[model samples]
Target: MPRELVDYRDSEEALRASEARLHEAQAVGRMGDWELDRDTGSMSWSPQLFRLFERSSALGTPDLNEALGYYSLESVELTRAAFWAAIDTGNRRELEQTVLLPSGAERYHATTIVPVKDGSGRVCKLYGTTQDITERKLAEQELRRKTYEIEDLYQNAPCGYYSLDANGLIIRINDTQLRWQGYEREEVVGRMHAAELFSPASRALFGQVFRTFKRMGVLHNMDMELLRKDGSILNVLMSSTAIFDAQGNFVASRTVLSDNTDRKQLELERTAHATRLADLSRHMVDVQENERRKFASALHDHTSPNLAALQLTLTNLARALPPAALPGLQPLLDDAQALLLDTTSGIRDICTNLRPATLDYAGLIPAVQDYAQQFRLRTGIEVHLDTADFTMQLPSNVQSLLFRIAQEALTNCAKHARARNIRIHLSNRDTRLVMRIADDGVGFDPHHLGEAGTTSPGIGLITMRERAEFAGGRFSLRSHPQSGTEIKVTFDVGRSGVLRPARRASDFANGTTLPTGTQ
Candidate 1:
């Protein structure tokens, strides 16, 4: 034979081998082949097909009825109808049905049937394959059940769940979060970034928090405010963790959000209540001081002058008496004068205590000077008042508050410190008024004085602090056992001064000029 003829023969043999291998491959894949002879009305099944029907090849070719009987009753009817329909219409059909094997085990098989027509256009045969698809069907059913479970959890979970991409874009959200925002899931998911759900100020804070989270891997209990679709803000306690890929690069984040609006509202309400209480306290102190001033004025104007006049009248009457009568009345007159003098002095002292007259007679400096003089005269403890750079004309209320604070400090020092010498310094600098009172006295522990059951109860100090705070000033006291005590108070000059910014020191100090409204 020639070379071409020999090559052609070899190719034909190779083609036959390939076809055989293809058939073997199909059988190995649990696919059974079948064919039908139209003229004989006989069906031929491969060995695997016979096994698929739970029968041996000893039964040989089966009739259509025999093949139908191998399927369940319902499957049998369905398959028979489909087979005949395909044969009559020349249409192909593929379907899955269950069959009972000889071992009584039920098996699922997928069958494909193709119709063949003869030269006369009459259906002659059907050929197709049947595959064992039981495992695939079971796996598909399991997957569908798990998918439903996951969806149910996402829809009904109590906490808000959300996922954001690396750019803070919202990728996924659960029904809980959508409901919180008064929105449907479709309204926001994949349509907005997480930052978009926040107010402008909150967005800036969120950006910083997000960067921190990215660097830290997780951020817990981050308090933030989120804006809803309706433009209302919600306080939320949120926690989130960054999701990373296998390579450890951040990909997205998962966040859990809880509504804390009620808690935030409660906190705001508490702050408001505190402010109201503080205001009430300040108003009470003002009222008390006004009452004291009224009482002090009445005592000075009505009581002290009456007592002095009574003493003078008694002295003139005693001098006019006879010598013998004078001796008898002298003791009485002397006692009357002493009592009158005592009454006048007591009234003056009470008046000063109620509202120091020096405060009105002179400026704060002269008032402090008079107080120091009186204190030293009474206690024999030397007190020095140093007032410089104190030219501002302060509001009367501020002046009263400062005076009361100084009075309280001096009284406390006298009673508790048992000091010999005291120094008070008042100055104005850098738009602020500063006052310091120091004593070379036996000092007690400030902490102990503030505590319960300690020597020298700190009621006076507490009162002083409250007074200073009411005046919009700061107060602090420093003292330790065997150490000298120091009390300092500072107030903003702009707030304390009654005069305008343009007022000069001479206008206030020299009394040459009055404030804008004063005569």
Candidate 2:
């Protein structure tokens, strides 16, 4: 049925159709055929060949010399030798040459030459095909240039870059990383394991995480110490991403090592500076306490006794005066007694304010209690002291620190808080001596305080914090605009607070109840 349906009328028509199809295919490929006669140095070109050269039928097919004219100077000589070689050897040859077009542009042409022979076994004509491969050749050149640029960038980037195989061996590393570790590429890659590049401590951590990394596929900001070839250490932060193949199998990891030595050194210096500042603060607090104690001792021992002696003298003198003299002496005696009494009271207050006798005689708890009572009386604020579970014979300096911080905090509350009630808490809980002063008052933001210009409060908060920290304790203050304020200080007293024989809590702060058990 198929044979009957096909119609074939003329063989010549079929041949013409076939040749037309071939011409269309060649044109699409930008290829044309050529032939040259060795005998006459003449040439023949295909229909597409003429079009490729941008010549019309009027300008007949170019001869050997005419075709040679299209090539650039260098290519022409090479093409000529290739043609002569093909003719002499009776074999085929191919070469690429830059050909100049009539339109004043250049194009790369790939030309192939083959020698044809007669039945008499002699060279006759040359047959070959030429293709305009300008686009392909230009593309190849561009690709090579870009590849070189990418390789340069990878080698010279600032951060150290490296890749590791699935076995944790170094597969590739950049010049920057190699230089940092004092190693050439030949010594490290494929020879050193990733763990060998790090210090022993870092190696332990890296070993553990590297397992997890293989599974998790990502890790970030891992601080590690790198051991250089010269036995020195370099701190580095490592971050990496795992690579996977097309079938979702883990293949390798790409890692970046960032130099962190400068940051590490800065941290060390900061710690040392903080330690020095703390030492200085403690020294200053000691000197201040000593001065207060000396001043208070002078008033209590010397001045108070002198005033009492004078009062006694005045009373005895009145008793010894005569009846007529007694009238005038009585007024003088009364005025002298009143003046001395006032002066004595003034001196006692100055001594108490400078360094309270209770702080030295009764220890920190009793001193704090006495001061709290005074603070309540002076400010007309209701004060509550809760040391019901607290009793310890702490070092005198520790006692002083706690007392000063409480005093400063209470003073600030009275002056700025505008509150009605205050609660002072001293307790030993969880092996720590914790003291908290809380007030129901108009509060302010602590952050704005002690800033460049001003804040809602004064430097009292700063002083309190310094005192607490200088004594190796932690201090915290919490205050908001509408909320109340609380200052807490904790000293790590351990179970020793419970170990020592304790005094009654009421001896210090009158209102506080002594512990039922400790009492």
Candidate 3:
């Protein structure tokens, strides 16, 4: 053979090799190439194209019928119609469809058919590409389904939810949030943001939270105030998270808010009620103290003085009688003397009941001693009083309350205990004033006694507890049937003894117990 003929043969071999390599590359990419002859009504496909259609064999020249048989019935008809339409219109067509392989596995494909024309400007051949897009199509379908599900959740969520852009502009909001604000979706969507829903005072706070969330990625359970469209304030418990893009740049904020207005209102009302109850209790105590002072003053001033003058007159009359005549009149004198003594004693007892003079003149210890003496004299209970490790003068009110508590305890013991010795102890230790009253007599269960003025109608223990509490103290009592009773009260003397301004004489005359030295 000539050298030129040999060279031509080698170039032809090289072109064939290059075509084989192109086919190999298309197969690797999961793509197939095809060509059609319009006049001859014949088609040809690369090996990859035959494989994509799941054909077991590729004959000399394939026809449209062979390709249609590879597609599902529905897809075959649609694809055929679209192919003919593109051919007649001289336009390109792209389609996606599913076809069952010979092995019975379903495959997804994308086909793009392009028309080729002869010099006469008439269609003669068609070229096309097909790609196996099963993975990509399945992924796209899954993404669409998830998007719909998320939209449903946003529309029907129970709590309000919203998203705001970096500029605080409202980007999206849930239907629940719109309803809570008394607005329709069209009214506020993309038109307002977090700041728009905040009261003036809360706007600044909202800004601070937004900035913080942007840096921190999440803000949890923040309590905030919001202004509704109706110009009412709503309390909300809010939580938010900052959204970030693929590059980790802050994009927007997603927040969930729950209404707490009702709970907040209940808490506020409870606080107000507690404050009012405290004020009323103080007022009642003030009134009670005033009444006690007035009664005490009346007993000491008017009643006692009149009884003393009467005794003086009787004494003068008794002394003026002659010594011999005095014997005959001695019985009358003795009666008058006894009557005066009884009247004076009655006056003193009445005065003590209203306000014990020893409590005002001395202190708690002396007053308790005087109380024990009076109790012993009255009930023959053989009372004893003891004090230790105490030197400071207590506030007059504390002294008065302690003395009253002692008085009530002794009275209860006298009426109910029925048996023997009573002991009263007042001492100070570790900055606390401790008072204990114990009776060795018949005792009743302490728990069985209900509150003051309840079924028991007894205020002895209740009064002591109240007084102790008023003085920042704790009160406790222990007793059992026939086991005797013991009452103990402890007060932080230094804390409760802060001196308040003294009240006046008229205040005391109006039944108020003005501070003893305040006069």
Candidate 4:
């Protein structure tokens, strides 16, 4: 073959290879090219453009009017406006269009139109490039929708939210918090400090804790009160966490505030209810005691005197009887006198047990002494009194309450304690008065104690506790099987009534036989 013929063949092969590379590049980019004849108002499309629209290339390219039918109405108007603007100004413009394909599928395309000018700089023909960007466009729409939803949630969350800079200056705040404080967003962010949002006490605590928070990176469930625009307080539970930079420097903080009003009100109501209940119990105890006092007085003042009179009359009758009928009548008169004397003595004991008069007349010390003396004589149990570092006048009610407790304790000790020796100690401290009753006997579990006024074994321990507590005192019992039982009751005398110091009797420590002194 001649040299010219070989060179011609090589050039033809190079042109085909270049065209193959161009087609591969366009296919990879999902791009196609187009041009519009300015003078003839005609259009031309590349093979890739036809494929993107799901159409065959055998048919001639569509005109502007025919192509508009493939686009949605909104896209048609946008394309029309952009086309005319570019044609008149000789400028390049880009537009996105949604096109309906012949295969009944919808697709997105981004198109760029460049105007071609003539020698006189007048716009003539147009060259353009179109890309099949359906996948990218759908992805963008999904991302935009999700972004809007997240922004909405952040702005209108249930609890208050805010962000502060390292210096405690407010930087970002959500709409919910702005509404809570009755302030506009602009008024808080960039203008207010986080400390200014809290009440004075809460602010001080926040300042102290915030330093530690920046170091620890977290703080939670701190109680605080925020001041609203109207200067009203809003109790809230605040939690915070700090954000640090890569170098471990504090950068920002995010905080959440939840209202704690309901819980606070509930606590206050519970406290008030307990106070009312305590007062009612005390009143009922007082009413019961008053009735006992009146009944005891009636027996002492009237019944005792009447019984004495009957006995005296019976004695006189015996003395005045004649010598003739003296033997027969004397026996009957003696029986009547004996019965009257017994009735009188029973009435006196009843009055003393019902409500000891010494408790009201002398004081708690004398009243307890008298009861202890009677208890020892009646039960044949050794009783000891310990009154150390105490000498003062107590309120009548207190004296009565203590005496009753002593009575009940002694009765229990005699019946159940099987005790050989019992001890009673009374003392006064700064603002409290303490009394203890202990027994050297087989002790029982304190938890199994029975009703106060019941006929059960223990001496109305329940009754003793009720009396002590109703008088604003505390009651405690300590015991274990085989050890010993000790009862301790304390009264806040300084709070209950006048508690003054009395000059101590130096010789009062000398153990005396009488119950009035230590034994």
Candidate 4 overall lDDT versus native: 0.79
Q: Tens-digit lDDT track for model 2 on 154-183? A: 777777888999899999999988888899
Candidate 4 residue spans exceeding 4 A from truth: 1-31, 35-51, 54-63, 99-108, 116-127, 132-151, 203-218, 243-252, 311-354, 377-429, 432-437, 445-477, 487-519
Residue 125, model 3, lDDT? 82
Residues 1-519 of candidate 3 have per-residue lDDT tens digits of 999999999999999999889888888878998888877667888888877776656355468777777789888987887778778988998998888887888889898989888898777788899999988988999999999999988877777888888777888888887777877876776887778877887787877767777888998877777787898888888898998988888989888988888878987776555445534544565576568767888768887777788878878887898887888998987898798789788878887787777766787777778778887888889888877656657767667767878888888788777868988888876556778888898776555665364334145666666555544455667777788888887766555464221222222232211111101
Encode model 4's per-residue lDDT on 1-519: one tens digit a residue.
899888999888988898778777778988888888878778988877777777677777987787678888888998888888899888999999988887779999899989998899988888888888999999999999999988888889878899999899999998988888899998999999999988888899998998899999998899899888888888899999999999999999999998888887876675555445445655675676688889999878988777778778777877787889988887888788778877886786687788878766777777778877877777888888888777756777667767778888988888888898899998887777889999998877655555465444444666776566545566677777677778888877765573222211222232221121121
Q: What TM-score, computed on C-alpha atoms, does each candidate reach?
A: 0.60, 0.76, 0.52, 0.75
The order by descending lDDT is: 2, 4, 1, 3
Off by over 4 Å in 2: 1-9, 50-59, 100-104, 243-251, 265-331, 351-363, 380-384, 388-401, 416-421, 428-433, 440-484, 490-519
Off by over 4 Å in 1: 1-161, 204-223, 238-255, 314-335, 360-366, 386-395, 425-436, 446-455, 465-477, 487-519
Give the per-residue Cα lDDT of candidate 3 at 178: 79
Evaluate residue 314 in candidate 2 and report its C-alpha lDDT on the 0 to 100 scale: 86
Question: Each candidate's lDDT (Cα)?
Answer: 0.77, 0.81, 0.75, 0.79
How much is 221 displaced in model 1, in angstroms?
A: 5.1
Model 4 / residue 22 / CA error / Å: 5.7
- Quote the positional error of residue 150 for candidate 3 in Å: 6.9
When sorted by TM-score, best at the front, the candidate numbers are 2, 4, 1, 3
Model 3 bad stretches (over 4 Å) = 1-279, 391-393, 428-432, 450-459, 469-473, 492-519
Model 1 TM-score, all chains together? 0.60
Report how far residue 468 has shifted in candidate 2, in Å: 5.5
